[model samples]
Target: MGELNQIPLKTDVLIVGGGCTGVGIFRDLALHGVDCLLIDAKDFASQTSSASSKMLHGGIRYLESFDFALVKEALHEKNLWLKLAPNLCQELPFYLPVYWESKYPFLWMTKVALKTYDFLSGFQNSAHKILRAKETILKLPGIKKEGLKGAGVYYDAIVDDAKLTLECLYDSLLEPNANAFNYTKIDKVEAFGDSYKAELTNTLTGEKNSIIAKKVVFATGPFSDDLLMNLGFSWKNRLLPTKGSHLWIRKNSLDIPYPLVLQTFDGRIIFVIPQRDAILVGTTEIQAKGDFFDLKCSEEEIDYLLKNLQEFFPAAGVSRKDILSTFAGIRPLVKKEGGNAHNTSREHQVFRPGKNLYVIFGGKYTTFRVMGREISSEIVHGFGGTYNPGTTLQALRQPSVFPTFTPWELSEQAVLESLSHEKVRTFSDLIHRRMGLLSLSNWNHKKSFVDFFTGMLDDMSRYIIVNKAEITKFWP
Candidate 1:
């Protein structure tokens, strides 16, 4: 994992971003025997890719907009990944509670939408059912009882977004000619006779280098607009950057066996998902401004989410005190006129600014595989290589060192394995992305995080440079 100093000067393809879409394309091309190099400004999936709502469902709400085609494609990819990486993803039941004042007053409307959702998945998803108010309350304790008619129980997949992206990158690296570097940024690019030369800088060491590739691809997602303009690529802003935020609350804050879909008074849908020993609630669609990197949840957005939670679970007494941590991500929605961010389509768009440059933007996390194949097929064919789309359907070659959503003792061997194989560059990367420790509060539930990491600092340093100050910041 000497990615910083040992980067090649030339490759067949150079991918500019290491988000889910970029890593997905890297795997697809690597599987087809393409010499590829992928670079990211920070840890892979540290941005919008990891900041998803963490659900892999056909947008049931999208059906209202009649986006059947996008729903169908996403459903297929969602179901496929459920099979491809069973450990990283699982099918879960999502409960949509209905009230007397609900937009869909009757349960039949939800039933119709859910039936259509399953149909879009070719009936591959588990069947959905309508649960009576009593059953719904029993399933989700402490829920608001007034005006509750019934709930719609539907099946959707839940994914470990960051780990899934990292695993895809890991699988691509198994190919002999594929390589990737994190904390590496492409500073500038110059076209040279059907090829492009990129100036890359290692953000950590402040080292500079250059890479020449026959084709350059920008899978920059929400950062597409600023990145393209900064690089002087003559590209207009194509993204309607919508900021969505989530909160991780203590699991005891609200006891729900499964996820609850709450329809806010503003007609937006909020998901209260349970995962990794905490309750995950999110998502407000607002026009995003300022720097988009490493975004955090705004107080207004947090209050909005908590207000909805209070509305749904009036007796739960959930407040800011119950919130363990909060995260925000920008959605790179393809801009459309008139409608608000919530109504904008989730469809992806690809642009070829020049003969040798490809830019893809505005797609959901669940449909990344298909979005990536669209670019990979053309790039592989351009190189005179036979692109078999089925090649990427295979299982990932390397799994993460830590098991997702399972209880395990954090042993010395586990730390060594993560540092050695998971491309862990810093203590934050090890804790947040690779090890899946999202909330600081969860650290107290387990053993002393500080004590454990302090003991392993010497060994962790042998793999990658990390200091006690960095590890102390995460201490409870």
Candidate 2:
């Protein structure tokens, strides 16, 4: 499955995009013992999919809209994720600090939401903890105390999104007939009889090739509409991309009395999540137009986030100077009639526009596996009574990194040690998304970190000398 420049290879399934959705499909198909080929226009997970808020929790906020099904599915999948990749996914306790001046001022109603979340999660992992106002202040001394009420604490999980995506791709590559190449773009796609043909070009090298497959799946997320249009389909309005931005600030001791879900002035929600030595304050949801790849935190967004951060933690030292990094990502949401981006539905869609063509639209990071299974089921049904869908369920427990290793056996530290400096670079790249070390260490990213990483790279250079600048460029 390596470099077929002149050869036109046939496959059972051809997937475009190496994002989470594409890799999820590949995992499902490979488990079913199918012939598949996955191609990405860039390195795997080097897009919006990997650049997520890194929360693997069931969206508790969705309960306000009574989206029980999405909540339930996400909650179940969250547990499955914990059991399958414990090395990468971890349970995190979050706090919801209440303010008397806020619209949702009633602590009782917040308790109701927390209890609902607990019920949805089967009351797992300290489902909800209600604390007095004084207790809340003790936990977060920086919190505004004037109109402060009690707080509701709950459990959710955070994950290393890039690590998970890479492991998924690695697992898929291990399967026979499953191959992935970065910088490969499916330029044009068309139905040929009952099958489909696509012209693929390497975006990096400008090399072109054609591939044919019985089934072709489009998992391009926000860019799905553009790709589908190239395939002669007019499926506009399938998704409206919503841009979300987050800022990473070097943590001070005063930053987190604990993980906080601070209330925004506009009734929106944001998490002041505490990493070991840093705090992540995120997420502004606005309808995004033009380019999805060209996402950066606007001055307006940074100001808005800072104002909100000041409202809750006035003396937390959260200025532009403390910011270590800033990132933005787009959520592929199904186009709705009229509402703010945050109010848009978070449900997923799987549809077939033609015989053997599948397109997945609209889903959150937490429910990817379930989405994969559902789409795989649809693909199996289109195979005309040949393929069995149950195999995917059997393969559900398989780890995307090391298939033989159970959740209990896989080690996060082991994975970190295994990476070369050529492989992992930047403080954020190493701890934040690759090793789960952000949660594990407060002593990360000191002068020692650069030296430690440099030492590792020097050792790796003996075997595979890589251009440090080239490899580290993508990290920051």
* Whole-model Cα lDDT of every candidate shown, in order: 0.88, 0.72
List candidate 1 stretches off by more than 4 Å. 1-5, 445-447
Per-model TM against the reference? 0.97, 0.85
Model 2 alpha-carbon miss at residue 441, Å: 11
* Model 1 per-residue lDDT at 383: 87
Write down the RMSD of candidate 1 (Cα, Å).
Answer: 1.4
lDDT of 2 by residue, 378-415 (tens): 66666653555445443223233222112223343343
Report the Cα lDDT for residue 421, model 2. Answer: 20
In candidate 2, list every pair of residues with a backbone clash.
139-257
Residue 251's lDDT within candidate 2 is 74
